[model samples]
Target: MAEPELALDPIFLLGAGRCGSTFQQVRLCETGNVWIWGEHSGVLAGLFRWGGEAANNRQLTKYVYPREPVSSAEEIETLQHDGRGMAWMNGFRRPDLMAAQRALVLELFAKRLPPGKTRWGFKEIRYGPADRVPLNLLRMFPAGRIVHTVRAPFASIESAIVAWELPTVVALVEQNDQAALDALYLKHLDRWNGITGYLLDLQERWPRKVRTSRIEHYEDERRELFAFLSLEAPTGSAGARIFSKADTAGGYPGIARAFAERRERFEARVAANAGRAGYG
Candidate 1:
């Protein structure tokens, strides 16, 4: 086994959660020409959060917050246990954290990349506009590619609702009340709007570095996607389909019909922003 040749333009698969990106990740990994780690968004995200490159409500005392003296052992213990002491102990700086994160990311990929393979990357679901991973990745690999995977809005929302343990679209129909179903539809519609808005912002900001693909037309766009990734087309056992519509939300007739009924509400948004991604 020889050293895997890293790509000048590593790839990042981006999309809303439950949008069929796992299938794409598996298929692309099957090519054997690219080393792709699936669902390790947290690795980059942790570094981002530590570095103040991204923000979340989860942390009560951020490193960027005013430094408070903790002379007492009890105060020190409390701060450490409360998640604010590590940054304080480190002088509220993140250079060491940033270095450790980069080294860890590289080591993880090195362990995973097959010998003689180049062009390694990862697939992560949406991390919002403030995420530092995208820019951090670019700094690490200036020409890195960002591929946004899209799905039909209704199907995506339906899939997301179920996966996120929210009420399913099917349940709305089964409840058999028009107002209830309509309200469910509206809720999902709002969720999808946020998703598409984020994607559109990324696409616009990184027009040259970013591209979109639709899950619906993945079969047709398979070759182009591989070519874009600088991978050879996969065949034989590796190329066999690993994902099936029968296993996903779209397979259910009732759910499909429910989505269709509300198609008009989301169709215009999709057509306007997702057309390039192959969603109509």
Candidate 2:
């Protein structure tokens, strides 16, 4: 069966969790002609990884298909018999595999468009360079654009700990587990560094197809963002409600004391990462 074509080229909003990407998605949807969906929990990333393995299979490339067409039933029988001994006898062609992948993605993300919407896309937080998401996504949708959203590492990490009720944070607050908290903080800091580094590399490779959006500069970057997406800026604060107050009410006494003890080191790490990610 043939797959349906997408109504328009897609947009992928990529960011770490708690990076205001949800707000960016909502704001983009306010354009009335666009529909930006939420995360699918890395399903597409997994699919891409699976496809990548197949695409890179050297044995499949060498043995799956004949260099020339078979001319006789005896030759076909011989090939079939030989194929029966191999593990990947039915390996797929690259183009066919990509088509199948695109069809599945369209079914999941773009099949049922709302009446007035002409474009559709999704926001995901779980993809990083290791997943090769941007690379595979571009192969599937050559015209697609990627928006890499970012927030300050310290604020983003703090927000994620509270909002997600991370175990390390809980232990730090309740059990005074400073070592666990330190490990957790370092893990997230490494993640931020990797994601930001990947984004910068992607931008360098595909400058016209990728853009970075920072939470702190959302208001100032509004016009540029809309323009980049070829969207009309919503007029007169039509989408002004996109911004929500940051959740900063709770006090983490243990965390505070720890930060006081390690403020210089933490600040230096954040500054180094933020600078790499194009933040001031």
Candidate 3:
């Protein structure tokens, strides 16, 4: 069978939860021919994990079939008589496996496009450097572009805790446990640091393929972002709705207090990493 041709190269919008990724998606789609889908809850990341394992396994590499099949009867006979022949766990060819993986991904993301939409992609918050998702995804779609969105860590954590209704964060706030809240901030800060560091590395490695945007500066960066993706920048504030703040219903004051108390810690961590990421 022949390999399927993808109509458009995929674009991955990656960020921690509560970042303005959805806003970015909306703006990208406003170009009229792009359809950037919502998060699938790390489904693609899970698939990439499986592919990475199979691709790197030493045993699979050693036993996998040759790229070209043996045509000669003498070669077949030699293989049949050899102590380590194709009969023992005859594995698949890596190229075939990769092609199959690409086909499956295209079926999921690109096959069903809305009318007038020729490009397709998705936004995901569950993938970070630790998951090796970016590396594996680039392997699958070398022409793919990644937009790494970021928000102030405290603001993001505060919004995520409320948006997701995290039990631990709720309990800590209810108990008014200042120390626990500080610790929590530090924990999330470490994770954010790691993700930001990885994203910076990606931008450096693939300067043309990776771009980073901060939520607070989205308005200013909007034109540049559209141009980066080769899309015509839309006029007017059609995306104002996406930038609207959610109604935290008087609950954010408490959350704000928790974050405020740990402001120094947050600043220190951001200073250590944000400068390198060009977010400072």
When superposed on Cα atoms, how far off is each prediction in RMSD?
7.6, 3.2, 3.0
- Residue 81 in candidate 1, Cα distance off native in Å: 33
**Where does candidate 2 stray beyond 4 Å?**
1-5, 65-91, 238-246, 259-263
Quote the lDDT for 280 in model 3.
59
- RMSD to the native, candidate 3? 3.0
TM-score of structure candidate 3: 0.86
Worst 10 residues of 2 by lDDT: 241-250
Model 1 misplaced regions, further than 4 Å: 1-9, 41-43, 53-98, 115-118, 130-132, 162-171, 177-188, 219-223, 234-254, 276-280
Q: What lDDT score is found at residue 44 in candidate 1?
A: 69
Model 1 clash pairs?
none
- lDDT string, candidate 1, 1-280, tens digits: 9855545667788776666787778777666667778786456666666665423323434554345545566666567765645554534233444566666767766456676567778888755555646666655566778788877766676666555533555666677666776677677666566656676676788777776777777777777877776667665433445334433455566766666776765577556655555554
Clashes of each: 0, 0, 0
Q: Order candidates by TM-score, high to low.
A: 3, 2, 1
Candidate 3 off by > 4 Å:
1-5, 65-68, 72-78, 89-91, 243-252
User: What's the lDDT for residue 72 in model 1?
Assistant: 62
lDDT of 2 at 12: 92
TM-scores, each model vs. reference: 0.66, 0.85, 0.86
